[model samples]
Target: MNVMKSTGKFRDESLDFQKKILERSGFGEGTYAPTSLLKTPPNVCLAEARKETESVVIGAIAELLSRTKVKAEEIGIVVTNCCVFNPTPSLSAMVVNHYKLRDNVVSYNLSGMGCSAGLISIELAKQLLQVRPNSYALIVSTENINDGLYFGNNRSMLVSNCLFRMGGAAILLSNLTSDSHRSKYCLKHIVRTHKGSQNHCYNSIIQEEDDDNITGVTLSKNIMSSAGQTLKANISTLGKYVLPFSEQLRFVTNFVAKKLFFKVRVIKSFTPNFMLAFEHFCIHTGGKAVQDEMQKVLGLSDWHMEPSRMTLYRYGNTSSSSVWYELAYCEAQGRVKKGDRIWQIAFGSGFKCNSVVWCALRTIDPTKEKNLWSEFSTHVTN
Candidate 1:
């Protein structure tokens, strides 16, 4: 069981001005913005967004292959995810052409699914490895902010403007027995959960508008609340399947104590220490508030969220690709080691929550490739 991860990122620094974007978008004075929106044109539009996305995907795939010492034609599976850009040619189809991968390779383009698409793509690749041994799977995660930039200055919509930046990540997964000894991590378990809420919850997270003259998509305001509930449920369900017996017993004990003894104080005190179980957490850098909520729920410390926070501050919210940036940060800091455990959590459209857990199979070599964190260390906030 071996896997290699190669990630890529691209941002439109000239388009958005950080300080003005924060104030105009109402993200507050201290809210981090990679670039300001004032510098960017109001009519930049989706066409440009698609072109930038194409560049990142092409560049990322090329970089991944170069680092892995594998040719594009050797890749057996291609999985790409993006929220805003869906062209007639399709992003995956374009990549297939750009890379000239084998004609028989399975390629998929996942759209409309929000940030959680990153983990979902990884899960898809892991499943492929089970059936097709020695196969190579390329997973690319990205988000196009230019398409979703809001002009009305509504706080809810403006949040997207301040938080999202241009970014993408490409990862290479393989089940080759030969690479097992050198690969950094092995995929262990993946849990995906979706919530169905009609009261503008789903509409808030993912919206389709029809105005006769034009049709467009916009994010609703209720996404954070809806996502919080969904994540709690998903974590509980996943815990039942993966938590160690001791932790399970503790949870059960607290429940029983509260029910029988009516000891509300003691029972309510029981919360699973997720961070204690996993050595590292690559939580989606969707926003500062999202990260804070996840940290409080998961019982993680400032250090646990350092990678996520740094990624968010440096790259803004790259949506699906943000988790990979956090993962890369941990690796560059030499935080991951053989047999260490890592947990990746992401929330996206469809009111969806997805999680993936992996264990390092071999030591990571920082010198082997470019690292987003290592390069941005000077600028990242502690």
Candidate 2:
């Protein structure tokens, strides 16, 4: 609930760039960036990156441990992900050492997986839990902007500076049925689709040195198009597991008609009514354009997108952890309820579209405790 805001010094430093890009970026005035960037001199360095990583990861992990009432030694697996920063001692290793976890704990560090890495981590944890019964897995999602700062005038690269911000989330998953009584939700399905083999999709968002020799992640003009393709593919696979029979039959009928009977463009592609399958949606707050495109493609209404839009306005694109912030926003607003289903969809650099489905296990009270969006009503307009 006590999410840190960027210092004035850092805001002042980024003011010029923000002004230039904010108009077209779909971001509000309140988006966050890291205070570590305000140091005497700023560039990608291990010290600054490490400091930012520890601040968010440790805080989130501490809160998770307290809420779950689980000790660090009880965690049988640890996974931490950050797209741009990978130090000598992995982030997972740092966490294990700092928390003094058990010596035999399985640890994995993931990097360069982009914003969808958080969901990827969850899928990994689910697999690990199946192998080891009655064990807990800790997953941390974060992004460090210290090394991702772009100095060049390349507008595409400069967009990252305006969009990405400091944020992290820690999640604890357990295989024990006993813990299910206390858990907020139960994992139902996870479907991941990757279009990395395609040249255009692979280069849509990439980290490389620009012409000026300044290294940064560049966003290509084809990013939206690439994402759309990946989403289509992902939904095709996911629909089998989540969509209602009526929706599935319609989709199949449309497909058969298009191939067998209709040669003229009479039938439009069927976008299964996802609204029937899930009560809530946590679309990645990648950018304004991406959010808008998703809303239109999925036939979603304004209410369905409020969490994503507001999360972007409040946190900027926190990379992999953005989805969690959106989910927290929904909880703080008292929108979640027992038996309701939530679908989290995330897009990342590999032109990946990943989704995680959860069924609420118990009723969630908005006023039960403070949350990331505890003050959301006072500050956010919508």
lDDT of 2 by residue, 312-374 (tens): 887888999999998898888888989999999999988899999999998888778568898
Q: Which candidate leads the pack in TM-score?
A: 2
State every prediction's TM-score relative to the real structure: 0.84, 0.92
Q: What is the model-wide C-alpha lDDT for candidate 2?
A: 0.87
Name the TM-score of candidate 2. 0.92
lDDT for each candidate structure: 0.74, 0.87
- Minimum summed lDDT over a 10-residue window in model 2 is located at 1-10
Residue-level lDDT tens digits of model 1 in 146-229? 566543323344345466777799999998889877677888888898886556557766444333222345557677788877
Q: What is the lDDT of residue 363 in candidate 2?
A: 80
Measured on C-alpha atoms, candidate 1 has an lDDT of: 0.74
Local error of candidate 1 at residue 13 (angstroms): 24
